[model samples]
Target: MNHKEINSFYTYLQSQQTSQRFLYQCYKKIDGIDAEAKSYENCTVFMYYLDHGIKFYNAGKKLDILMQPILFFYGMVHLLKACLLTKRPNYPESTSVLAHGVSARKRKKKDYTFLEDEVKVQHNGLFPYVSQHLFFIHKMPFEKIMMKNLLGLIPDLSHLFHFNNQESMINVSKIGSHTIDFTSRVLDNYHLTERAFLERIKPYLPPIVEVKSNHTMFQIVLTKPILEPSGPFFVDDNQNIFFPTIRENFLVVSEVMVHYLLLYNLSMLSRYEAEWWGDLLITKPDVDYPFIAEFLRISAKKMPLLIGKELLKMK
Candidate 1:
């Protein structure tokens, strides 16, 4: 999308606060669905349906609400099947990339064949049936990096109810050591200045953020007072050496790397947990279930309402 289109969409989102309310009601109605249906699978379908309906509607046609959700449902089925077949790795690289191999003139024929065979074996071993399905998902129109950025914003949606309660406050101090290690890894991979990354995302950020970074770690604190009444609140810390921005608070803290933008909310963090969660999402082998669940809950509640209002205002 062009800058104007992006700006228009964002403007629509900002203007339609009631859309968020509608989304929350939808989530409340759909809450009892299986986690797979509620979270990743359903979300994939929702996005697909939105994309399809928007495309169709733009082609000089009336809107079809039923078509929108049905398209989403079909898309969700494909993603659900893939998720079930292949145990998705925390990172995409863990899966195979080669679907087919062609002979290369520069390499000896025998050597090329050998390499291809090896790759095929490795692909089969790592991905199996599920991996192939996942490959398709990766190929979907929305780039993985874009999805990551979008997902990073999810925490803000949930901040309404979770930000400052003692029970909900996330501790970051506990994860400091891990965060440091992860930050180092990110530096090794990207090698871009952190300031550039921050500049790219600056328009989306609130003022007065607290950032911490060393050769080995990066952390950001969004002081509670800075949050707007209608949010996009929470702190974020990225401990992964490859992705230094927290995927929860939409903040970037590293100064010298630029492979991917990490954004997340840190409202649930204690100082230590913030540090550790940052590190884990960036480097570790597991998905942060609580983090993912909370984000899904809030985004589902808020985003649709926001989008709906934007749609009404478009005319």
Candidate 2:
């Protein structure tokens, strides 16, 4: 969906009655809570969370690149908090849950590059909370991830990476509503036979109904339509799914979580490492500028659509 459509969709959440009804169902389904009572108390706060998120997103659009990360990161946080409320009901159960839930290196080396920078996942805070509650992902505490890997995970930016002579992903051809196809080269990349490949991916994807293959291509038939991203697979701008070229644990990281990590680090750099951030943008000192700029633009537009899709699934 486009920004206008997503903005209008979120606008519907402004209704207290509607939000209460929605939360009532979510609370009952997700946590078996007293749906009506909890919804009654939380609906207004939920609406405000979403409202604040959209406002930050809208304001970010008018700002310069230097300020966009701060706005977008907090905007993403609010939306994520709203999502958490649907599942957890009593979000911010403790002071720890309110933290950013991830951290960057305390100090950068003299020759540090943005792409080489990393963030370590924390045990408590919004990151892990949202991951487990909303997305059902359980991340290892203090697990470190590099900026290059996170950027490669975004399907929209895959082409940019390719232009820079790095192959990060392989496009999956959606053959039908319930089936997807990819070349045998994928198997070659992993050095796995069709049967072996299926076993490796079965843990990550939805249930498979059947598989069809020839020498050149393999077709995976799913039991149902893929409504959201899973494992190594991610939805592109056209809403089609693609696979990462490299098979790694970070492949399990959802696109939403990836954006959160990158934005958190960027927001921190923008706020605390202002001199470096300014030099990176104004001086164009390295190759990070184009990728970073492209990501900021893409994340500004795509994050809302992903969040909107998540909210729609609740309905």
Candidate 3:
């Protein structure tokens, strides 16, 4: 298997690398960009990237040309997301102003007791949203780096607790999207028992959650509700995806297993999500998105077992 450079291949790579760095710098330059956008009365940098992304897709049939749309998308979405999560305000304000917005509806002050818990040296991290994605990449053999990069977009687990073999798991984390994507394809294509298959996988699930909220110092816990739902369908409320055609609407079904993976690892994963969203040090005084809190409210019990019912039906 041999391939040639798509002309400005190195240049394109440099652009992507540059995009990665500047996108990260959006936090620093956001106020200036915002001032310009506001003076010109235009959308913010985040929306600008998203709009360009859509335009590139709708332009025409994209030539392989270094996987332009996919790579462009990879860089844009992650960077834009980082900026949006950092939501710089129009005027001056303390950074924590946004932090308080996204925190969950705490039943009591005790709910945040984990904040006072002791810190420990930790290493390994969790690979999330793997179940649905793993199946698509491996079993279905979708060999695009789009899937690989999307899966790697948000790697690692809660800073509160980590595993030991992060060195090896990090490799798996990069390959996780492919692996999880492959797994879903296998489940549907091979007509495996969804219940029995997941049940069999229960024993292999890792335990890494350290709930320091209660009197317990550092007891390990696993967020495992997604593994076993009360009915054939698992209900999720926040999922609002639009695909006009039946053939093009596979994302809804495909993401069902992703929801499962998220549910199973909600504990540590929630913390990770919050920390990233709340990362204000990178930005000068900005508000953070409460992505973790919104994620917590997703009704898994109500979400349809998308892959089990829809994808399996297609098979």
Candidate 4:
């Protein structure tokens, strides 16, 4: 769905009655606990988060690019908190879950580039907490990801990488409801044989029906549509699936997590690294400008869709 539809979807949750019902069902399904009282208590707070998040995104749209990251990052965080409340009735059980849970370098080298910079995941706080509770990702303490790698994880931004003579993904063509097709040379790209490549992707996909191949293309039939693909497989804004051409390691990150990490760094830079942030925006310096600018634009529209989809599943 587009941003407009997703915005409306979030608006539905703004009602106390609707929000409480959703939380009730979600808590029952996810935790199998006493949900009635908890849902009633959390519904107001949930609506507040959705309200603040939508406002932050709205404010970001009217602000200058320099301030957009800060707004969007917190916007995503507040929305995520709402998501967390669905599963964990008593959120912020302690202060540890309140932190951002990720850190970028405090000092920049004279020649530092944003793409080359990194963020390290901390053991506690909202980042890891949501990673575990919302997305079921765990054991991510102290893991370091380069900014460029995180940017490459976004399917909507794949074209930006392609414009710079890089291939972030290989698009998969859908032949029918059950099958998908892609170039045979994808095997060469990953240095995997057809059998080996199939084995590698098996864990990420649904049950396979069969595989067929020709000199130029390979087709794999699946048991169901890839409605919620993951890792190496991603469904883009247009509903097309792609296998990331980036390293397998980078492909494992979900788009939501990728956006969060990138926005966290960008927000930090906007807040603290004032000199470099201003210079980059005003000077139109390097390729970093294009990637960062494109991401901000895309995330402004894309984040709501991502978060909205997650909320829909909870219902």
Number of the top TM-score candidate: 4
Question: Which whole-number lDDT from 0 to 100 does residue 121 have in model 2?
Answer: 91
The list of candidate 4 runs beyond 4 A from truth reads: 2-5, 30-32, 174-176, 248-250
Model 2, 133-211: lDDT tens digits are: 8777786433898899899889899899899998888778442368778788888778788898889778766799999
lDDT of each: 0.31, 0.84, 0.27, 0.84
Preferred candidate (TM-score higher): 1 or 2: 2
lDDT of candidate model 4 versus the reference: 0.84
Please provide, for model 4 over 87-187, each residue's C-alpha lDDT reduced to its tens digit, 9 standing for 90 to 100.
89999899999999999998999887999999999889898998898878776633898888777777787898889998887678432356778688778
Candidate 1 regions off by >4 Å?
1-70, 73-184, 187-189, 223-315
Which consecutive 10 residues in model 4 have the weakest lDDT in total?
A: 245-254
| lDDT per residue as tens, model 3, 192-282 | 5544544543353343233222232122234542232211111222221111111111222233333322332333323344543234223
Residue 19 alpha-carbon offset, candidate 3, angstroms: 23
Give residue 128's error in model 1 in angstroms: 38
